[model samples]
Target: MIDEQTARERVVSAADRLFYARGVQAVGMDAVRSESGVSLKRIYALFPSKEDLIVAVLRHRTDRWNAGVTDAVDGAGTPRERLLAVFDFLAGWFREDDFRGCAFINVFGELGGGSDRIAEAVREQKESFRRQVADLVRAAGGPGHLAPQLVLLAEGAQTAAAISRDPDMAGHARAAADTLIRCALDDAGEPAAAA
Candidate 1:
């Protein structure tokens, strides 16, 4: 018999794959059980409900997001590059064979209005993303106001990349972000920072 934690991980992993590829509403518990190789009875004992499972999956996605973006930013040599690394990360993600856009956005559109818990999960993830961007902006010597605009560029790029099936979307967003960063620094009267 699998331990509770192990089983829970398996279930969430499988559900995340299915839900992101398909829609959350399109997949059923039976499919999760099948993909996870855990019994349906055991799945329920672990998740209690589909919503519970989705929450777990969102948590998993958040973890992945944090790690991936952190790694990309860490590889950069400057705050400016670090700020742009976000789009670099997105470009890599977009190139993946399983690329399907932002899972949080996907979940939000499909079920945000119906479930408070799910909406909150999505909100938490998005807020975390915004905070990450804001921190990068600060490090790059950009004004506080630039964070939201940079975020919109990144967010819109993700959507456009997914819809257009084009990985270059990240490059486009990065160019726009570069322009914004340049202008923000100029407006702040700060000398042009190294890229």
Candidate 2:
């Protein structure tokens, strides 16, 4: 028998795949139980309700994604490169076989403007992403507001790529990001540095 930790991890893994592929609302607890190979009782024992499971799943994915972004930026040699890392990461993600829109955005849409705990979670996650991007932009010597704009562009590209099934949409986004960075630096009386 799997240990509690192992069982919980299995359930989370299953939730990640199912929740991302299909909206959280579309996937039932029974599906999570079957996919994780855990009994329904065990699944409920781990997560008291579907909402709790959704929150757990969101937290898991958010942690993983933030870690990836941190690694990507930290590995860069320069601040400009670090800023560009966000785009590079998204570009690669867009090419993935399982690529879908941002999970938070998808969940928000699935909920349809309902004000609930899940919506609040989604909002917090998105704001966190924007803040991270803003910090990177500021570090790159771009204007203070550049991060929000870049994040908007990135989110728009993700939505477009998912809907149009066009992976290359990331290229346009990257170019736009480059221009935005250049403009921001110039506006700040700083010259853009080579990445």
* 111-171: candidate 2 lDDT, tens digit per residue: 7376487888887788889889988877777878888888888889999999998988888
Worst 10 residues of 2 by lDDT: 186-195
Candidate 1 RMSD to the correct structure = 1.0
lDDT at 129 for candidate 1?
90
Q: Any idea how many clashes model 2 has?
A: 0
Write candidate 1's Cα lDDT for 10-91 as tens digits.
9999999999999999999999999999999999998898999999999999999999999999999877789889989998
* Lowest lDDT block of 10, candidate 1: 186-195
Q: Best by TM-score, which number?
A: 1
lDDT of 1 at 18: 99
TM-score of candidate 1 versus the correct structure, residues matched by position: 0.97
What are the runs in model 2 whose C-alpha is more than 4 Å off?
Answer: 192-195
User: What is the C-alpha local distance difference test score of each model?
Assistant: 0.92, 0.84
